[model samples]
Target: MPQDFVKIAQRGELMPGKMKRVDLDGRRILLANVDGSYYATDDTCTHEESSLSKGFLKGDTVKCPLHGSRFNLRTGQVLDDPAEENLRTYPVRLDGDDILICLT
Candidate 1:
């Protein structure tokens, strides 16, 4: 498949254990920095419309602030309750110092 990767942020823009919410092609994507690795997933919570970037990051899991739904950043799997369906995950990569995310 042809990948449409878009550079969303610089490496220095996001610190470890931090996350940022970006709007790409009118889609809400949550970019997370777990330790030194980068991960991307849907920004909206499955149960509620809360932004996952506003939530807390614990290891590779992110806890939803609204209703406490935890999701794995790497696999976008729901690790805790409140969310039945899994969030969509995107491929993330680095080019030099630019953080790129695959939208296709």
Candidate 2:
């Protein structure tokens, strides 16, 4: 199947160690720029549906602001409890300053 890549954010729009939330087709996705590298994951925390974009980014891990569930930004792995399910990840691509995400 062909992948549907969508331009989500600009390269430098989100600085290192920061995160932003992008909505595509009603799906909220969290975009994290960790030391110039980018990662994408579902914005909602699995534990209680809180927005992960409102959380804190530590290195490559994002801790849920509500319940403190830490998730690895690189692979969307649940690094801490309160969120037993891993976050869904999206493929990220860079084209010049355009940050694209594969939604499919």
Candidate 3:
């Protein structure tokens, strides 16, 4: 079977209220740590093609730097206007010191 979960980050590498961008197998994924919980989503913004990892993470919401659009990190749902499409989310889990994200 193919690998289900891919390692995204290490513990302490990403703190609460922070987001990071990871590239794996030509895929760009946005990883966010909200209140000690992890969430993964597409790094590209739905509004503008700006990088969401460069955006701001407030609580469970992320604001795009290009158009200031906000999205829920947990569900990839847009919390603001200007973005009609929702982001694609991935399942995240912590395995020891490894922060894994399911791309499958």
Candidate 4:
């Protein structure tokens, strides 16, 4: 069963072009605000197990600091080489002034 979407943070907490790491029921999630929408994905880079939240954010993409792997924040797809798997993405929604992440 899919877990209900939980409020991770306030909308104002994560600014555009910034990434924040949050623990969702023991799962590490990368919460990013691109433009004005919020997105949630696995915090760890698939290829190197590095923290994607600690990486640099360029527009809607995040560059992995370990191997320079770039991932699309919206879809969690690897846009560059060296990453063999797509990042795990979670459903996100805005609830009032809070950002809700679905952990299914």
lDDT of 4 by residue, 1-104 (tens): 65798899998898887889998799899999889988899999999879988899998898888998999988889999788788999998887998898887
Rate residue 102 of model 2 by lDDT. 95
lDDT for 43 in candidate 1 is 97
- Give per-residue CA lDDT, model 1, range 1-104, as digits (tens): 68988998999999998999999899999999989999999999999999999999999999999999999999999999989999999988899999998987
Error of 4 at 51 (Å): 0.2
lDDT of 3 by residue, 37-93 (tens): 999999999988899999888999999999999999989999898998999999988
TM-score, each model?
0.96, 0.96, 0.94, 0.94
Q: In angstroms, how far off is 82's CA in candidate 1?
A: 1.0
So what's the TM-score on candidate 3? 0.94
Worst 10 residues of 4 by lDDT: 1-10
Q: State the C-alpha lDDT per candidate.
A: 0.94, 0.94, 0.91, 0.89
After best superposition, candidate 4 residue 11: deviation in angstroms?
0.8
Off by over 4 Å in 2: none
Is 2 or 3 the stronger prediction by TM-score? 2
Q: What does each candidate score in C-alpha RMSD?
A: 0.8, 0.8, 1.5, 1.4
lDDT string for model 2 (58-89, tens) is: 89999999999999989989999988999999
Query: Candidate 2 at residue 86, lDDT?
Result: 94
